[model samples]
Target chain A: MENIIELKNLRKVYRIGEEKVIALDDVSLSIKKGEFCCLLGTSGSGKSTMLNLMAGLEKPTKGTIRIKGQAIEKMSEKKLAKFRQEHLGFVFQSYNLLPMLTALENVSMPLTFKGLSKSVRDKKARDMLKAVGLETHIKHKPSQMSGGQQQRVGIARAFVAMPEIVFADEPTGNLDSRTTKEVMGLITEMARENNQTLVIVTHDLEIAGYADRIVHILDGNIEKIDIINARRVSNEEADNIISGADAVPAGV
Target chain B: MNKRDIIRLAFKNFMRRKTRSILTILGVLIGTSAIVVMLSLGIGMNESFRRQLSSMGSLNVIDVNPWYFIEDGRGGGYSGQNVLDDKAVAKIAAIEGVEAVTPFLQTGLRLVSGKYVMYANIMGVDPNALEAFGYKTAKGRMLTEDDTTALLFGSNTPYDFYNPRARNNYGGGYVYFGGYMGDGVERPEPDVDVLNDKLVLTFDFSYGERRPGGTGGSEGGNKKPKLYKVKGVGILEESQDERAYSIFMNIEYLKKIMKENERAQGSMGPRPGGSQQEGYSQVKVKVTDMNNVQKVQDQIKEMGYGAYSLTDVLKSMQETSATMQAVLGGIGAISLFVAAIGITNTMVMSIYERTREIGVMKVLGCMLGDIRNLFLIEAAIIGFFGGLLGLGFSYGASALLNRFAGGLFGGGYYYGPSQDSIVSLIPAWLALLALGFATLVGIISGFMPARRAMKLSALEAIKTE
Candidate 1:
């Protein structure tokens, strides 16, 4: 498998009242094509920052991020926006769909930026919604749908453009356990089917267990990397291990 | 990206806030309506004045009078001098804008019938030269080059006969031409037909032969006398006030009568006193255009003579109209300024409210130009519709004004050949110019807000809670 995303000594710093707080210090990672990798960390452990840097939404303070072998840290804002539109997709934890558009419209948004025809974009968006079991809820707005359904729509949107990489910031942060499993399952299944790399940031061990590999973060540094046989375990057995691991505090 | 999408998005955005859009458009409507109405009224007034002046004479006529030296610091006598000669008349005619010149010579004469003698002023005009100066014939034919020996009667003269006791009988017997042809008592209807009537004039000129008392002699002894036949009747439609009391005769006929009288008296040689009778009292020159009347008048004045033109009246009318238009335009501009402010406010508010939407579009790969164009198109749409509605309102208002003015003044106040009942008189070019100007105003008013919208940071906008 080819690496779709590569981070080299990535560092992010925030100035808080004249003090440089290192959000991510000397972080390095690689995400292979079609690989589901989760960045598991407690709050403020720089997980979201890492996701944002890989998604080309923010520039790294020091070091470089390459998406499909193209360095994004040196890219201009205009080029970055084009790069994001063409090669990167994002699902925010809050399910940040435009309130003005329906689930179908939200799914078609990235394709719109791709300059596709309306008919083609709409048809692709409809097909993605059907793949996510949301054909009946196509016209429902984000405010009208549940958190899990909205995340499902977000997942459909992220993959509708068939981008090389999909970066999700805590995909199941606002869902109940049942809905979390359902949404995470949908994201994993769709990303795998489309041969798209999925990079997820989450504090929930259950959500991290859904990824083939998980990288643990502590205080802006990678603490450990854990590989799970996600394809070998039944979904029920995977849920038991995920819920059993939740008994421990996230960082321990 | 394409025009269709841009227009569709702009339309959708505008339709989302209907009340605000309508109010903004209304502001523009008031501005455009004011401009249209003011300009229409100005045009109407100009046409009215032009029509009135045209009716007065050849808008091209210029009257020339003799210039005299002051005796006691006041212009007294003519000083027995002929300032404008036949050569000067010819020279004036040769001027670029001069169409014709008629040397007006007037002399007091007694017109006598049997017992009905009326004292009249005789004005001499060249029979061939009157037509170019806006003279029209209402009854008989106009004077011709060959008809130099006849007189032309004015239309306003009364010529009727009636019996004394039949005045109340309506239809009665009357005597015609000294013959008693009557049924009971007849009064002839007032003669509106006085074309080609004869008028006889008798005048006296003094040279060296004066009476023992040193006064000019009467027509009886050693005095000049003349008579001319009636040939043409001219209707002075424009100058009835000036021509009503006078009669027109061929200039050559008057010259021939003078010559014959001088020859019959055997005074062909130079007179003992050396006075010449070849000078005109006044000369009225007609120019080729009303616009050139003032220039020609000035040229004439440069020859050390006094001249006047209708331009003085025209100037005063133009000044009054300019003042009126300035006042009207000021009011209109003030309203337009208020409307512009309203547009600015609406745009600013829209920018503030749509910050997140702007961010979304930016992220969706909409260029900065596209965003600005969208706002400009929205503003232009408001201006376009406003201008259209304003034009309609101006049309209606001008029509009502024309009708009211016509009713009060006993004739249409607006002057034009058509005299259209609805005088919303904006010329086509002016309407186009108004619409264009309004659109420009809309664009300019939208500039600041569009810039602000363009400057919005996508990160801040999208991250805003």
Candidate 2:
């Protein structure tokens, strides 16, 4: 399998008055194509910062980021925008969809910048909405939709352009347990169907369990990489483990 | 972005803010209409003056009169020979821009018809010298060589001259004295048809002989019973003096009458040495071109003559029109300035409201140029519609003014390039120019706001909640 994203000795630092706070320290990681990987960390463990750097939404203090073997950090602002649009998709925990746009319109936005005709974009966005079971609610604005439904629309938006990698930061953070299961299941199924590499950042162990590989971060460093394969745990078992259950199988 | 899309978006945006757009347009309309109305009035005034002056005489015609310079010691009595003669008339006609020249012979005479007698001035003219004298016959016809007995009367001819049967009380009832000849002879029993009929002249050389000069006052005087048949009455269309009435007759007839008088007195030895009429009393010259009237007048003045032309009237009219235009335009400009300020206020408010939208557009890949173009297009649309409305208002206003004030102002009050009315006219070019100027003002007013919108940082704009 080819590597879709690679980070080399990534470091990010912030200054607080007279003291320096390190957001990420000497972090190195790699994710293969079509892999559903999740960075699991508590608060202040540099999980969100890692996702932001990988998405090229912010410049890193020091480090190199390569997506599909092209250096993203070296690109100009204009070129970086194009690169972000073409190679990556983002789903935020708050479901940051544009308020002025309808569900379908929000999903079609990334494609609009791609120079597609209105008809073509509409058709593609509709197809994505149907895939997420949002065909009946395509015309509803984000404010009109429920939290779970809004996340579904966000999922549709992220995958509509068929980008190589999708970065989802706490995809189920704002949802109840049932809605969390629905949104997580939809995201996992869509990523697998499209053979896309999905990188999710979350503090919730149950959300992280949905990924094919879970990387645990402690004190701004990767502490463990657990691959769940063959004998995968059921969602209920993952929930139990996240709720601090005592025992679980090694692969599960 | 493509132009069509930009225009479509601009139109849509304009439609969204209908009230603001209309108010801006109204401002432009008032400015444009005021300019059109004011300029038309200026033009109309000029045209009215021109028509008034033209009716008085040929606007192109110049009048030249003889001027004599007497020696310092010479008393003013006929000190100089008549400078305007046939030779001088011919010379003036040969000048580069001279069109025609005519010499006039004028004298007052009394016509006696039976017991009815009336007095009038007579003008002796060569039939071929009409244009040079700027003569126009308003009634009857001008004299021709074959009609030797023809008499052209002026408009002011006494009523009895045309109606012979009409009663006359000039001398209390009726009294006859016959027509007076230059020599003071009165023939009794004169032809009664001479009131409105032709007279036949008879001359007998041996009828009257010169007596020896003595204190008995018997010096010989010429006498002739020459008659003239009233062929026609002519009305002079133009004259410098309204009260100085005159009539025209063939020069040949006058010469023949003089000769008969000489022969009747038995004083006809050898004919006078010079041509019958030695020189003209006054010569009037017409120039070939109206524009050259002044130049010709100047040349005549240099030749020691008094000259007058309508160019002075036209010049005064031009000056008045220019002054009127400036005053009127200044008034219109004040309104235009207010309209521009209105546009500025509207654009500034629009910029304030659309700041966040502008930022979103920038983030959506709209170039800085595109953002500026969007705002300018909106401003231009406002200016264009305003100008159109202004023109419409001006048209309505001018029409109402003409209808209500036309009579009070008089004819030619509303003079257009091709027609006359009470309301002034707005020409097509001026209307077009007004629209363009309004649009330019809008663009200028929108420029700073558009630049401010463009300079906004996208990140900052997006972060504005």
- In terms of docking quality, model 1 is incorrect
Question: Least lDDT summed over 10 consecutive residues: which range in candidate 1 chain A?
Answer: A230-239
- For candidate 1 chain B, which ten residues in a row score worst on lDDT? B169-178
Per-residue accuracy of model 1 over B366-400 as CA lDDT, tens digit each: 56667787887777677777777777787778777
Off by over 4 Å in 1: A1-10, A16-21, A27-252, B31-192, B196-224, B233-307, B394-431
Task: Residues A1-252, candidate 1: write the lDDT tens digits.
Answer: 456778899999989998999999999887777778889999989887887677655788899988889998888766766777777777767677766578987888777666677899899999999999999999998899988888899889888888877888777777888998888888888887877888888898888877777889989999987757533222343445556675543221
True-contact fraction per candidate equals: 0.10, 0.02
**Model 2 TM-score (2 dp):** 0.56
Deviation of model 1 at A35, angstroms: 5.9
Clashes of each: 5, 11
How far is each candidate from the true structure, as Cα RMSD in Å?
A: 9.5, 11.8
Chain B TM-score against the true chain B, candidate 2 = 0.64
Q: Residue B153 CA error for candidate 1 (Å)? A: 6.6
